[model samples]
Target: MKKIEIFSHNPVLLKECVEGLEIKPEGTYVDATVGGAGHSIEIARKLESGKLFAFDRDPDAVLVSKKRLSSYPAFVINSNFCEMKKRLESRGIREVDGILIDLGVSSYQLDNPKRGFSYRHDGALDMRMSKQGVTAAEIVNKFSEEELIEILKKYGQERFARSIAANIVKRRSQKLIQTTLDLANIIKFSIPAKFRRNKNPCKKSFQAIRIAVNGELESLEIGLEASFDLLKAGGRLLVITFHSLEDRLVKQKYKIWSRGCVCPPKSPICVCGNVPLAKLVNKKAIRPSDLEIATNPRSKSAKLRILEKL
Candidate 1:
């Protein structure tokens, strides 16, 4: 029973996520988003004859996870979790005992100025998790005001979406909003000063832009289905989301999967034949404890949900 202790970042909902998996020492597992390898190392350490496959979109995370899980039987893949099924099939793996997805940007990305994920940091407005594709800057500058409003409202749940979108368009028309702070300042001014109290007013806008740049929601939608299809009977799927939007998507998807029949109110003959594919392990989403939030403020918004294949 050796330990893996080569990580600097504290993974959100660590205890809850690991416990939710209900690891079988000899069962195969996958860490769908092995950011910083904090969760990977723990899962790998628990494995005996079982194998661990860790995946991350960011090459940096892939490298870190590989190093951390080196002592254990783990393979780190430099790809998004949405490709889990294809990548696993390529490795001749058809079914897995458990799959864990820890969503949202890692602390490394948020702390690094080069990644442009943090509202606190002043850097290029590039928020691509894979460091590829359209940047947050491009979304802010090139996207129409309506497009900006939609993303801010949908992804960020921002109340000042219209004002912020208008301001972004106005600012970009005058000057190409180049940096993260450049956009942050625009967002801050757009929102009323009274609404901007102790908390940062730019957080929502930053999240919306980052999500748009990364295509996170779409990936999650696909990844969940792929993961469930790859799960063996009684196998578990655990997801830790950092925002309400991601959590809502996960919740609704899980609810759909857990449903047994689609018949109307009066007619009950099991005509649809929709047997439940999975059952919710926890009736409600698991949230981090108060102590956990005290220790890691970044985890305050995290919600963990577990579902087992039926």
Candidate 2:
């Protein structure tokens, strides 16, 4: 087996998340998506006797993070965040004091060509965040043009979804699209020559295919709900999302859970007896500072949203 040199990941909005968690010296914490132990290490440092349960679906990430955080005695689980509630229950951990979810592809994954996350890399078109899923190549080559267009429009927010889908189907007819460069080229030709000059013309299509292949957006919807339920009263959840689709889901879920009642105003009194689950700590998403953005261009699109359980 070949050895992979995995680099440490810089958690986006690191300070913001740690502060929002309001870490207590002896409070239990959970890092639902411990990509590279970035925030997990800090959470462990702040804890005197508190325990952190770190979860990640990627085996590569799990191995690296376990090694990086080995000294801290953190419980690292190889599982998706959507199953976090069940996993914690089995571990005899009832409620957590704080939960931090960094919901973006890690730098390590993007940088690794074998992972096929970056359009720059010339590798197999496999964009699975975990080893247990379909690949980007399958989605691009097998999906119907309409299905492809829907993914591009919804996940990527691409304006040329129709044209891109049409071109993909047209190209795949002659040859199988099996690599990052192959798909990138197809996306490039789909757009008119004038639009090709724009920054990252392939970005939208690649993002769309990646999201679909990994079921990322769907998992976010479920994971957000699970995270809210896992928190103990007064416990906080800090989620960092990278794109509009993710940010929108996080915002909408928080708004619903934060609502005081669901009954119509015409009702004389509250019927559902619903209480707010969490309160938004930041009504507006927190963003990276100019200095941070200058240092890490990837942080430019990050948005951090926090909620304290009521």
Candidate 3:
């Protein structure tokens, strides 16, 4: 077993999440995606008597979070954030005052070559956030062209998804695509010259593959709803999303919940009488300042959105 290192992952929009949480000194809170316990530590510090439940799917993250938060009275659970309800129920805890989810791969995962998260590393094509899930290698070699295309198009937002899929199929037929370099090379060859030079061509494909491997986006959507339901009235929910897809999902979900009704514009009377569940605390997402971004480059793409239950 590889010994985990004590490297730091600067949590993006740290102050925003802590503030957005609207932490009550004696109110319980949950850090659903407590990677490295960056935000968890802050929450724990603010709590006088309230408890903190920190969840992480990755064993490595769980281990690291345990070490970081061990000093505080915290319960570190190795579970998917999507299973927030059952996990909390098992603990006999109900109605948390706040929840925070940082929905991005931790610096540890990306930095560790063995995890196979970064295309920069020549690691095995295993991008499972949890040890239990299917790997990127399985999806790349086993999934049909259509499946590959769908993943690339939907998750990656890659314009050349079809070509990438075609190339993957072609290459794997000759040899098993087992490593990061193998797939990265195939993606490089599949894309046009101009496209390859502008940005890391393999970036999107790797992201898509990772998402599929971990079911990350789906989990976020599910976890968001679950967290919403778990919050007590006046309780707050804070989400820090890295990319556009996540931001869009969070935005749409918040909009739906914040709206008074979902009936058509021309509907006679408000037929879908769904009262607003919560109000968007920040109509515009909060972003890290330039100084913070300079100090922690990983914070650059983070967008923080907050909602308070009515």
Candidate 4:
């Protein structure tokens, strides 16, 4: 078998995430999505007696991070961050000083054609981050038109979700959509010619399919709760989300956690007896600087948010 060469990953909002963590030299921390170990390396270097636990569902990422972080006091686990609480607890770690979760596809995943993450690449329609679940091709061919439309509208925010879903069903009836280019062509043709010239019409549909295949949004929801529950009082949880949907979820959750009461506006007394779980580090999401976006185009959509346990 050929060895997979691990490519260097440029971590988005690198300085901001580390600063938000406020790393204590002897404090234990978790790097929930140690893609390419870019952020993990930074977190590990700041440690003296502190330990870093890094998790990644992708086997390729596990191999890369394990080697990259081997020099430091870091332990790399091959698992999804959604199971972080259970995994950390199994290792006798019930609480942590900080947790950093960067929810963006690594540059390596997109740049590598075989990964089938990019529509620009004419590779197999296999967009599994772990390479162990339902593939994009399976979804495109097997899912009902309504199911496809729902994901396209909800996850990708695609305006022409119905049209695109119909086209996918129509095309797959003739033959299986087995490759990224095949699906891209169908989506491109589904949109109006004028709109196709403005941007890649396949972008939204591809994103929607990938998210559905990987259960990304669902995992994010579970992972956020697990991360928050595992943080000790005053410990921080930093997350970097790439799109509006993800940003909105984080924003809403933070709002709920920072609230001191849940009583109805009409009620005079605090009957709910709700207490704030955490306070937001920033009122708004922290976006990448102009230089960071210019240098790394992929960081353009990144929005960072932090909450400290109360």
Best model per TM-score: 4
Give candidate 4's whole-model lDDT: 0.91
User: Which candidate, 3 or 4, has the higher TM-score?
Assistant: 4
- Candidate 4's displacement at residue 163, Å, is 1.5
Show the colliding residue pairs in model 3: none
Off by over 4 Å in 4: 264-268
Q: Global lDDT of each model?
A: 0.90, 0.88, 0.90, 0.91
Residue 84 lDDT in candidate 3: 90
Q: How accurate locally is residue 163 in candidate 1, as Cα lDDT from 0 to 100? A: 98
| lDDT of model 4 at position 192 | 90
Best by lDDT: 4
Pairs with backbone N, CA or C atoms under 3 Å apart (clashes), candidate 4: none
lDDT of 2 by residue, 221-283 (tens): 888888888888999988898989898899899898888988999999999999987799988
Clash totals in order: 0, 0, 0, 0
* Residue pairs with clashing backbones, model 1: none
Q: What TM-score does structure 1 among the candidates reach?
A: 0.95
For model 2, the stretches where C-alpha displacement exceeds 4 angstroms are 262-273
Candidate 1 error regions (>4 Å): 1-7
| Per-prediction TM-score | 0.95, 0.95, 0.95, 0.97
Ranking by lDDT: 4, 3, 1, 2
